[model samples]
Target chain A: MPTSSKIFISSVAQDAITHLRIGAFEELSRLGHDPQMFEKNFGPWPNFQTGVDHCLKKVSECDLYCLFIHTKGGSMTSNGYTVTHLEYLRAVSDSKMMMLYCESTIMDAYFKFRWIIAKYIEEFKLSQGRMPHNNEVVDFLEMESEKNPTSGIPSKHQIDTYVWVLLHDIVMVKGHYVEKLSWGHTVPWASYLSDLLQQGLQLLPKKSLYEESSQLALAFGDFTSFAKQVVSDHVRISELLEGRRLLNRSIRMLTRSEITAGPVNGSIGSVKACSAICLFHHEGNSLTVQYYAGDTNGNYDFEVGDPSSFVSYTYNNLQDGVPGLFYWESRRLFYLTYKLGEYVISYHFPEDTAWSSQLYADYTDDIINGILNTHANGMIIELLNSLIGGLQK
Target chain B: MSKKPTRLPAAQDGWHVQTTANALSPDKTVIAVNKQGTVLHMQRNGMSAIGKDTLLFVPTTRYTDNIIHHKHQRLNELNNTLTGLTVEG
Candidate 1:
């Protein structure tokens, strides 16, 4: 069974029309959730103050805050905040997961009301020194329209479509001024809310509820051992060592980070040890690099022959030189070279400042990873062959 | 009694003259002799007034050539302006 949650539903009592509020509450209960709505739960208290206090207490304890807005704005409290608005404020303060749904349809002279609200958006912007959120800005606008009802009228369809579009924009892209507001028919609204709640529930730790057993522990141990064996069988110890060296060298070269590095896993360091050093030079707002390494005897696409016989070869219509080392070709270029019993050094450079900002600033490790992963040896070999192969008579 | 001593005409008087107006070119000289024998000769600097346009008789040349013309003017002015100023011994 799903974990039962207390969902506090905030809406006007007048929103009971077509059973919108009650329908949502009933749906939540049917889905194994405890729905807290004041409309059905509020009973005759000794005083109105006592009733308000009881409602506030209930809202404070809710796990999720579900707010539905329709035509009626509801009665204002002593602080000039609507009861529903106060509930929303409390929910935000408590950081409860919130789901917002607004109805598109409104009755009683919708056109004149829309015009007043549209004018008030400018007023709100002027007072706030920035544009107001699409949701509340319209609400404030509606307040102004009600005060001065004899103005240009807007079509009902236009207002409804406008609200729907605003809601769509906020829902699709998060971190907007207004977050997660949906305006549509009832069927889609319930489905969307259910999915959102389900996603939130999945983020909760399900494993914590399961009891530990000796059999489960044995199974986990076997799985981990098998996984490690498979990885060792496929990936060479040399490649892992090379990757570790590259990560360490690259991390040391960073002056200020636009891309931060996380800790390198210890598995690579514990395996076959080798010395591979890579160096970076910041020359006039561009990066120049050199990578030096020895004996890479994994099945690579481009294999290094006798380093003494390494000739300066240019191929594929590129600037002619030794395939790997000490060749400068335009901006953002790579070169590789090998020396007998010494080291294989490969260098790559940024072409210009613009390229450097993108490559070095954001993707420094990603670019380096190409030269150091499981396919590192093969990639370099392939790179050299593609260039050198072009030189064949 | 009627003819008060009248002034006699000089020998060079009564020379009928006509002025021909034509734009002068810079690199060539222009010489014109009217029917009355009044001669006109025009030259711009050492160059003729054939094609080059010049406000004065001096030939109008490129701005670059003016550096050679007044190379000493700027130095002379600066020296005169700072005549009293000198480096300390």
Candidate 2:
């Protein structure tokens, strides 16, 4: 199944398309995909890289790249190309999937403008005995417009020269479709954009298990023929161990453990232990589970299970019954570390300017308190089981 | 007394008057003298000359207006052709 995919939105930061950009962002997020735009997702850049470099890097990372072109070509970069143009080139060179859209009125003007320029060139050549340079023709048109303001000839300002240049390149490319967006005061641009993006998402190909395993293999070492065979075998085995089946089996194991400990105060401890066993069983030989038991005074017990029978336990030296909270945190760290294969971690907290800081604090407090209460009740139940067993014996 | 300039009559429908009659030929032309006493000639090329005025005898409209309309028609044709050629782009 395809989970969330990363989509990059490329366009000029003009007022005309501001609503369209935001609409795309919200719609992609609503459809459960990650929509990356510099305005929303980009944090502070490192000193060595410029904004253009950062943008290109993001374009390369995204699964799909969408470009919106309207009247303006956008601000030029140091290399004299507009930012949107460079982004488009990057997307092309990377062979990234693209969705192109242009304003319909601009397209109409482009054709007429080309015809007028051709005519002007022919007329100038006839009168001047030599072909006029582009700038000369532009100057002539300007002078003519000033001389006869009502000549009905469109000025340079009406349709930008660069727009024609960009459109020539984009439209000349074969096999790519350019959708025309009609311009009007009453047009529902936001909803129209959202529908287009949803359609694009539907056409995306789902990543297969073999492909994912191959990526993992390539990341680790040289992907030789032997590695290829191993990856193929791993994918086959993984397919056999379907996720839903594994989850059902885990639930059945927990139910059986609960029945065996019926009416005993140890039922909660049995359930926790069984849950840990099921988690490790599903992981197979890929991960090694560790068990930690400790008291508030910092005295601790640690056990590492063998590959065939992986088991782990953790108890913090904080309040009693808080062991599950510590366990959950450790599990998250382990998954991020070994499963994701990322060693470096960076954190940046923005200065309090509004409700962001307060919101973060409140969310963290609620999660930690909830985890503590759930685990603390289980620990108390275990303790009761111990006392009752002693009294009965 | 200047002997009163020879007052000529107007030219007929198919003929135009030309004061410089040096290029006139009688074999391939039909000449006329209207009541206004203006000498007129119709030429082989379908152009009629009256005194110094040259006009198309077939299309009775003014020469300048005809040229302007023709030019505008050609421009519209060119616009459509160019538009059709590049519309795919």
Candidate 3:
């Protein structure tokens, strides 16, 4: 596993805290973890996409969620919850690890304000014979704050009543209390934010390279075993092969000239692959490949190779309809091939003479299993249904 | 027959102190009642007061000149800490 985790920072998108948000992004980047913040990572969203949906999707994808709570609760979404509130809820439901920080004065005022609201609610209920609506409560606070400007309580404009409600809900969640140290007003916000991020990164789970490799191997082994069982059924195999042929033919006829390929680069070794081809268009064409070699100290040395060097063969192999895997005995290289739409892509693993035969076998099996389990399964189900229906007629 | 008004601790020359439990400090609650029997809650900065009827009883200890000065000093430090940051309109 890679040392850096994707950390999503959640906060109100207010200009007042732009510097603080940027400071967090810079600090988290300096510490080597990828930080996702709205100012840095969000939008240029599609016209149809809601900002809340994009933010919630990001919150779900992150390995860790960090929220900076200040006075503002931000604009409400279609769901009648603020964007930050929805993001926080998504993080909670997804069980993403969380780090929460709040401005000390605002948090202090929130508790006092909550107490005041409780009393006011009781008084309102006695007089009116019904519970006050959320808006009414907010209006009451606004009136009270305006009248008693020196009360030390935050006005509705200064701190949204929704923020107080959010804080109340956050506190009620088990083991999710904002630590006293996490609340600060004594230092500059930028420095304070950096320190908090540093502390948060330190608290994340750390795995040794060996342990992570072992875990990955174990997962691959389990999946491969299950896939092998599924592939052994002759009927299923025949159905899958037939489906692949039909899909391959259709794609080739539809998009033979338009298909293009490229590499998608990533910081981690797991995502460093030879080719990711866009089947229907020629938009993305540059391909890059990276190889990882482990040393005695459990560190990986990354070797970036040209795409052409890694891809030695580019055969059409249209006769088979499905791309075939070729093992060159003399060179000890394995070329694993698969077809996606009109593109026939091949990934070659050059023989590492030092690697044990068992390790080599396991690695090859894992790739084959992954392809068969995902792509093959989906295509087989769809095509098999059509084939079966035709045969019945 | 009207019950006699509860006598509270005298805060200054003409102000009487009324204490109530608050969220900030449960044990301490200090508001000042003037000679005219008008109640006012002292602000957190201790520099000013507002009508007690307009807010939940604000918490403080006995209002003294030294404590008020200290509150002002802390507020100044907090303001100085955030001097360069953009204040929300």
Q: What's the true lDDT of residue A64 in model 2?
A: 77
* Model 2 TM-score, 2 decimals: 0.34
Clash pairs for candidate 3: none
What lDDT score belongs to each candidate, Candidate 1 first?
Answer: 0.38, 0.41, 0.46
Question: Poorest 10 consecutive residues of model 1 chain A by lDDT?
Answer: A262-271
CAPRI quality band, candidate 1: incorrect
Candidate 3 error regions (>4 Å)? A1-3, A43-48, A118-136, A147-152, A172-175, A180-393, B1-89
Q: What tens-digit string does per-residue lDDT give for candidate 3 at A1-393? A: 555668898989877666667887887788677899887877677677676788888898787788888778888766567888888889887777677777777766765555466567656876799977655766777778888876556767677867765775575323255633233222243464466557655644332443455455455545644443344332332222443344344333221111111111110101112221111101134222222121112122212221122121222222212333333334444444433232233333333332222222223233333322332331332232233323222
Q: Candidate 3 overall Cα lDDT vs. reference?
A: 0.46
Model 2 chain A: ten consecutive residues of lowest lDDT = A334-343
Tens-digit lDDT track of model 1 for B1-89: 01122111111121100000011122234232233333334542332222211111111121111121132344344444344332221
Chain A agreement with the truth for model 1, given as TM-score: 0.38
User: Which tens-of-lDDT digit does each residue in A8-40 have in candidate 2?
Assistant: 988888788888888888877876778989799
Model 1 residue A388 lDDT score: 24
